[model samples]
Target: MIGRRLLVAAAAAGAGWVARAAWGTVPALGASRSAIRPYAAGSPRYRDNRFHNSEPSSSLPSGSQSGLAKAFLTRGATGRPRRAIPLAAPLAPTAAGELAVTWLGHATALIEIDGRRVLTDPVWSDRVSPSAVLGPARMHPMPMALEDLPTIDAVVVSHDHYDHLDQSTVVRLARTQSTIFVVPVGVGAHLRRWGVPADRVVELDWDESTEVAGLTLTCTEARHFSGRGLARDTTLWASWVIAGPRRTVFFGGDSGYTTRFADIGRRYGPFDVTLLPVGAYDERWPDIHMNPEEAVRVHLDVDGGLLIPIHWATFNLAFHPWDEPITRLLDAAADAGVTMSVPMVGQRIDGVRPPEQKPWWQGLA
Candidate 1:
């Protein structure tokens, strides 16, 4: 009876600690900002264009996006299914290694590439919603604490979606690490709103390249929209090409299938590792999010030596079974004879010698 009581007390204390971190009261990073970006408000990427400044229902301009159909695609997706979420921990830590990556669940990943630690879409909130009071709360605790992450080189933001561009997380990162922030154009506004130092923020357009702490960061193309409130297209959406001396990685921030993948391959092809989005897909809106099969095709298209599936298993932004993503992706990958790395949250896969990844989600219910 005494032991049971002590155990209960310990559990309560642990819960309290997690709650405090989730409330955004602590620093998650502590690195200096050396690769900050400088962009103007009147730049073409952030200029008021017809697609974005027009009606609420319209797709942003892109290579394949055109005409009346593009406008319709922007409105919304069909068959909006209800999605469930995991009760995730708010504090996840970076593992120890030469090149390590810890999945803070969902589309957020902490990557240590070429001796430089980087964060990609790091969202630690319980839910991915503008209004914290209403949305999908996590199903599991964050694997490690944000403060526990090591000094970072840069924080790469893919877009302004609630799931990717979380304000609270940004604030904490800003306070802790003088981390240089690399994001798509216009996303700098959101970071600025969150108290990020203007000198520490770098925003780029498609096909543009910048250098961050000896790493080459190229803002590549992606087929998606961006908006925090109803103001879509004010910000540009993108994937990224992170080139280190030892290896080059393609972060498929989020997008539907596009010929740009081939272009990226030609420009930054034969990536040692490709982190692609393989979930949150539907036939109704096939132009925005790529399904599992398309993700596999993109893996091959990028000429990736090893494929790592991200953007799933963290949040259920779309209506589908929680395991539907990994299941479909694995089957399709098997059919295509593609190699893959399916790491668990907080698990790191090395680029030079990444572990032989297994389908750890096999038993996930």
Candidate 2:
């Protein structure tokens, strides 16, 4: 009896240690509940002590949680590529001319305009979850190492989702780079807690604009929710317009199709290029993520010159086949007479005149 009791205590102590390690290492929830209340006051979207989407949106459908879980476990397993994904060693941005974009997989990309580089939604972690030991791991290696990235003029964060805002990556950038971090309103709290200098962090609400390295960055509205933990919408989500003196580009962080694109086009139309999300969508949550066809429509609605699809090919967040998003996007672009570029993971695409469309993702299935 004594030996059995000792074994049970030892097992309990081991389980406690594992749980503590998993939960404690996640970055702090950043801002206290009281701190974010002030930002919510004047904002039109803020109501009843939480931020709401422009269109009534739901992350998951009613009574679909169980179905989603079962689908994910069964169908999600088939979403991975059967062969190794190719990676392109990024060319030096200095040689890519004034306006260019290098897709760094997932939603991360480096946009160079007028000699200044803006990194959008930079996530360099191996996994996109609170615990490193558990969660969705990368489908392919990063095209370029985080430390090897060229000096960036600015860093734009779309939202506070783990896949978008990685704490480990943020901490490293905070220590290594002097570049300014432009984020949605309440994400500044996370940066502050993660040791980013207050002066280096610039938080903006929708429709607000800030100047960084002689470029205009306007925060635009997006239909999504934000939270690193249980408390949701404490931070705002946004799309962005990056305009230089000579060229302009739009970065759609992650959003559903909305007429807001037309409004944006009227105010800041005819962009040289637009980076839009094109994956991780399902009918169950149609209002939150746009399908590939919808993405093309938003591109056209924005009066965009060149369309580059993002948010796919890096993580298996959805049950769709790995190549389906881009495949469907190609068909839609061909149908719409819209110019599109499907650069490899690290290939640099010229903003002014993108390379001819290539079926690079073929045979990798």
Candidate 3:
């Protein structure tokens, strides 16, 4: 009788495990390709049922899969910091300033431009994956609670990647805030599935512009891919141009070294500040994510003034040392004679009167 009871308990445990995994996958996966295809079909980038980049790009180098697999096996804990990462309290500005930025972590940031507040790729979840218990977990807690964020005029999403477009964060924001979601074409399907009102979601294709709170948000080209499951490139990815009356800001969501930045610069040249990705880059996938040196090139290509780096220091998504990206970025920026501000998480930097760079990640790494 005891043996039979043990077997029964094992069966119950297996069932519970399956149920938990399904719970995370069903809603978190968002919309399928069929649901997204209808909205994306109208985009010029969409061809043969998939969105294509302006230039041909590969997610991984040819025949590098085996090498990448081996590298992952021997990666160890090189991507984690030795000690707790420092965090700074977000500045509570009485009103939106002319030009300022608060780097929450990773690709998430709050851009204050011309007296309007815009949140970019805000991911407040612990893990970024279809399964709640799996994926790249946060290295440090959020510096501040999401509920404490000031009134947001709009939330801009770069793509549908798990790290960039989190399902839980979108749902929570939809329930709590009245801010509209501005995303690339077909991304609105995911928001609608997450219970966000259709009217609150604005979808735009490349070169398309929308007005929000007296600011013009233009979807620009980015050399990247997008997907949440087996079907890839169902949705479009893009960088953004946030222009106001007096100042403009460029948001390099996530892209590789592409000459398209020069085109964007000519159209919207001389931005006051730029927020660019500087992490999760690997030689095997050089066409998708830019290295630190390449990031400096992009800053110049876009004619950016004050550079604020993002997409690092929050999660371990690459094999390099925890602080390698920032170290390399600082050296490259210095060599290029580029002005930059490396803010601690939640620390705000005013573009009009920028502060000096502080090496906060030095001792912790």
| Candidate with maximal lDDT | 3
Worst 10 residues of 2 by lDDT: 24-33
Cα lDDT computed for each candidate against the true fold: 0.72, 0.87, 0.92
Candidate 1 weakest ten by summed lDDT: 28-37
Candidate 1 achieves a global lDDT of: 0.72
Q: Name the better of 1 and 2 by TM-score.
A: 2
Clash counts for all predictions: 25, 0, 0
Greater-lDDT candidate between 2 and 3:
3
* Candidate 2 residue pairs that clash: none
lDDT of 3 by residue, 1-365 (tens): 99999999999998888787667787888898889988999988999989998888999877987988788778888899999999999995879999999999999999999999999999999998888776789999998898998999999999999999999899989888999999999999999998999999999999999999999999999999999988889999999999999999999999998999999998887899999999999877889899999999999999999999999989888898899999999999999999999999999999999987778999887
Error of 1 at 96 (Å): 7.3
Task: Report the C-alpha lDDT of model 2 over 1-365, residue by residue, as the tens digit.
Answer: 99999999999998987886498355644566566667656677778878898888898988988988888778845778988889888986444358999999989999999988999999998888877666788999998888988888899999988899988888888777899999988888788878899899998999999999999999998888887777888778999999999999999999888888888988887799999999998888888899999999989988998899899988899888889998899899989998888889998998787777778799876
Give the residue spans of candidate 3 off by over 4 A: 1-15, 62-70
Candidate 1 displacement at residue 33 in angstroms: 27
Q: Which of the numbered candidates is closest to the native, going by highest TM-score? A: 3
Ranking by TM-score: 3, 2, 1
lDDT accuracy of residue 52 in candidate 1: 29
